[model samples]
Target: MQAVRGVLAVFVLALVGIVSGGKMISDFPKLSVQQMCELMPADTSFLRPHTCNYWVRCPANNTSLEEGTCAAGLNYNKDLGRCTMAANVDCPYSKDSISTTDNLCANETDGTFLADNSSNDCKGYILCKARRENKSNCPNNLIFNPTTRSCVYTNQYRCPVNGAKTKSPACLSLPNNTRLANDEHCEKYYICVDDILYERECSDQSAYDVVLGRCVSALNATCYSTAKLPPPENTFCTSMGKPKVGYFADDESCSHYYICGDTVNGKHDTNPQHLQCGQGLYFDYEKLSCRERLNVRCTLDRCADTSLTYVNVLGDCQAYARCSGGATVGSGRCPADYYFDERSQGCTPVNHNYVACAA
Candidate 1:
């Protein structure tokens, strides 16, 4: 009975031990090597499992955990299901996990890391980034004005008028004394002269008036005379109104006038000059001359006597005559001892006493 009781007690104790071991295992959680390393203190012994290898380490420790090692197990925590350490441990908060937007070395309050946001290192870095991005913050010194953009070493510059690269000493020291020219770098400066830009010179007299202090043409009256005078006879003289008779002046030299002449017979002469007919009127070639036209007679008479019995003597009325009484006359009648003649009714023989002539 004593032996059996001892056996039963032993069984109970073994079962209790097994139950406690299982409960302990159940309370603990698995942890990765990284988690276990993070849990180690800055100053602590890192021991190997079952080999008795131990080493003192600090937060600076960069060692990796051996697989299936007790050192890993020693750092594990069942309650939190992770690892913990007392000192020299790299805490989760100390790890660098900044976003892409943030500067690696920038403090939270300030956005830059150099003096006045300028540093050779920073500049080099920015330039590298710019090159990588295939861009430029400033190109040709003209596209970007550095002064306005808060960059160093750049200002506005313009080309000079005369295209000179260097200015005279007077230009540099005095106001408005500079030349109207540019420097090799195409930079221009204002010249000083009486508080204004000094651009005039002695050689520019033709282009500028020293007395008037203004620009003017060089070909003024002072530099040239009026057109050459015309000849005396050809000139327009008020005294010679009628172009001097035989010597007629050209259209440009003559002045217009009028002349009066005689009227011949009942008609005024239509010619410019009244020359006689019997003297034979002819054109005078020596000077401009004129003459009158001769008078001519008509074949028919315009006036006739209607009371007399007669026929028109002339076919075109060039002349007229009266008819006699008691003649062989009808509507247009003739008088006695006169016959009605178709050509003329002047008294004639009854039988062939008169003959008509071809007028």
Candidate 2:
């Protein structure tokens, strides 16, 4: 009877264990089919009968497979899982779209072509279709020159010059419309166009004033090596021989322009005009001048670079803290009667006197 009882008791315990195990399994949430596929091995390759093999670029070191698609100017190749030029695709060809020739790109029209797909983690090449046939791995410092049909150095290059014994200074190529000073001649400067340098002489034989960055009579020329300066309205002592009255802008509010009045005891009296946009209003640069602060577009990354004073929604020039890498760095504020200059990134007193803006 005891043996019979023991067997019955074991059977009852086993039944209880089975029932609890089933409940635990049902309690766990199940993943969907898509999730299951994604969780599979990364470098997975499979085949469909009579079709191309499918592959996920799950290299051992890669954490995830890259998105599969060709760039806008390229066509995808299903067999190799790569992208090629529009003309290289094996699909239906459009005769009008491209002109194919075996002349090694010499007869090809002027354009740019990519040799391989860049969307994936694979190397690629850029080909130039120019009068002279050439191929290159256009690195960061080099760009393809269509005119020459070759890759040329960007920052450094040898300008073509006629035969002369005295070599010319290594001409620094600049963008079009950019002006640069000519160290050799004070009455002339240089401008760049089409990666070619052109010398420009000041009209009337005037000297190029470095401070003003323009041509002026030699007698009136005052060169400044740096661009940082007080307001353009402020007359340089060397130019006027004395301080003069005019409105100048500091690093602060535009509505609050500064005025430099007659010199007092050989010192210019710089004072603020104390212009007001309202109690909560701050000045804003609408275009070149200041108005009430408005909702101007700004990126968070740039706005956080340094401490700044900006017009809030309520129009007050409130202090903002500096940030580094999206983290706060420090905080600061301008003194009374002074505003922060966004250009110079410094606090400037409103103009009421002629003390130097730096002072």
lDDT of 2: 0.37
TM-score of predicted structure 2: 0.16
Off by over 4 Å in 1: 1-86, 90-151, 154-359
TM-score of each: 0.11, 0.16
Candidate 2 weakest lDDT stretch, 10 residues: 166-175
Please tell me which predicted candidate would have the highest TM-score against the true structure. Answer: 2
Residue 223, candidate 1: C-alpha displacement in angstroms: 83
Error of 1 at 210 (Å): 79
Candidate 1 lDDT over 97-151, as tens digits, reads 1121122233323222121121111111111121111111221222222233222
